[model samples]
Target: MNRPPLDRCTDGLPLPPGDDLDSVGPFVIRCVYALPRDGTDRRLGEDGTISRSLSAMQAWFAAQTGARLRFADEPVRTVRLPETDARIADRGSYVRDRIERLSRRQGFHEPRTLYAVWYDGSSTISCGGGAWPPELRGRVAALYLQGAYDDVVCAEDRFSPDGVAPEINEFKMLHEILHTMGFVPPGAPHHTRAGHVGDNHNDLMYAGDPPWNPSVIDPYHQDYFRTGRTDIPDLARSSFLDPLPAGAEPPPVW
Candidate 1:
């Protein structure tokens, strides 16, 4: 894969992680900025919005679970789509799938690597999408940045006791990453047909109403993150966590 100079990326993306495939650990999240040939490069990944949101996400995760996710070595990177804006932007339901496949072709698909693409392109689809573990073969998820185009940074004051504050972008990106990681297993008490917690609208994994008000990750602590049971899968045991064991296990096949 061709990479721009270490100091900056192509089309002015944030400084990208080095292209050292031999060194990146398994089960890590790779952040990417994606747009089509004719699409404008907003460079949100560098302009502080994405960086701040990631900080908030890190804070939220560390606050909730006592560990942060293992992001790709470089905080963020960029990918220029092969197609023109018209062809890529209007993919609708196929957008995530299309982008994931395309990213794989660009060499983003390392074993156990989950993609978190911030697509700066329009789509008829919803704000974001993630791969539900049970049905996942592709290990990628994406946020349609054009939807709402929200840049809400974490409301620090309101986020301490409960993780309510996050840029809607980080919030949704985390949600998609969780989904791709096979969260809210079918055996979870509140598992829904939509692969979310059916019981709490405030829970991050809940499939709730408009004006999404997610505040926590499995408030019950019995579903996905740190479920005290061994019968069902647990994210606490996932290799995606920072400080995770070296040569960590790959994500389980659901």
Candidate 2:
């Protein structure tokens, strides 16, 4: 969808271009999901539910970090790490190791603390918003209701019986992950009286009242990362994490 022209947020900012994982510090992330044993009865929709949801989540995450998305269809070999680190324990050591490797491969830095937790059933879950400490702010990532779309669909549009379609689930995943990354989209705040503008539905930041298709990427996101601004007021801040040390560079991109 087309987006209105944006003012540049990075003006006069000295941060370097591209994502450097080392600079952002170590992240503690967790991945949790509700899946059927057979994996056959998985919700099916435009993107076949599971794959689309995962892709959308990954896309949102990449946009947040100003990085690109890459996935391995085949099994990934994980390294064994010492269990003494508290950050590593929040997420399994195996998962942490995998994330580190993936971050390095993608030329991104792992957050100081990250968690990807998957959940099943309708449990009202929330991550500490911007109120989270700076040390922990960009360090967490999570995935919930992997196979089920009910919660996400219902949240977007309660009246529709097709509460949680695969596409909707994917969009919700993207939306929440963007939240974790610290980009609060327009229409997110209930009290805000701002009129809807730009690509509201396509963007994770925009409210999904009518429920736009998940496959479409919001141009505002590109504008935010590219020029680092959107018409939305709150997004004007340099919410992205600090830059890498002098002469430090991220590992080669995958």
Candidate 3:
């Protein structure tokens, strides 16, 4: 299917840049790992793994969009968040509130592109989880903070000791970030309408968990950013979190 010019958002919003993005220094997205108080055995924040994952993801983004992603050499921040329900409704706010709290406590940096991944323990369910308002299901695996395009919620079960590999977890993290960057493919009708990359299971942005190796950025996502389309759904105002509060630090600019 042919990719359409991004006209998905009923609301007017500016799509984040992909190719047009020029950075004085390499673009850096800070990732803070907030561990659960009753944390389990997930080692997502391990230095070697985290560094390698960031390098791999950065390479992919650079190869696809001509954007440079600089990984922070410092250790990932370990934080504590008040416990909250795992349902999507609560999870969204929980992630945002934590990001806000961390920002206030840690202070903002320049060239704003920050992500906080809250780590729970593990997911018992192999299938997805959701009830009323079907949209609220297993989306907790990871989510791009709808409007901001900066923050993301990385759910607990995204990794596994038995089967899932480190690179796989990294791929999931990269996938969610793409969503935030407005990588929803127009060629995928369901993804365009349902807010997931569903047309091809092989694509990194696939609605479900993709493989450990990760796929290249879909062509439509490339086109959307390359063409600088500014009307994508991911840029729409979030129906979830309230806007940033007053006295909030502004995001860093390039």
lDDT of 3 by residue, 31-68 (tens): 65554444453455664445555666666555655554
Identify the leading candidate in terms of TM-score: 1
Off by over 4 Å in 1: 1-24, 148-165, 209-211, 245-249
Report how far off residue 59 is in candidate 3 (Å): 2.7
Clashing pairs in 3: 111-252, 111-253, 112-252
96-155: candidate 1 lDDT, tens digit per residue: 666776676788756557787877776554566776655544577777666432343222
Clashes of 3: 3
Which stretches of model 2 miss by more than 4 angstroms?
Answer: 1-30, 34-111, 124-166, 185-199, 208-212, 215-217, 220-223, 229-254
The CA-based lDDT of model 3 is what?
A: 0.38
For model 1, state the Cα shift of residue 251 in Å. 2.5
Each candidate structure's TM-score, on Cα atoms with residue i matched to residue i, is 0.78, 0.38, 0.50
Q: Is candidate 1 or candidate 3 better by TM-score?
A: 1
Off by over 4 Å in 3: 1-27, 40-47, 70-73, 84-111, 116-118, 122-166, 185-190, 208-214, 220-254
Supply the TM-score for candidate 1. Answer: 0.78
Ranking by TM-score: 1, 3, 2
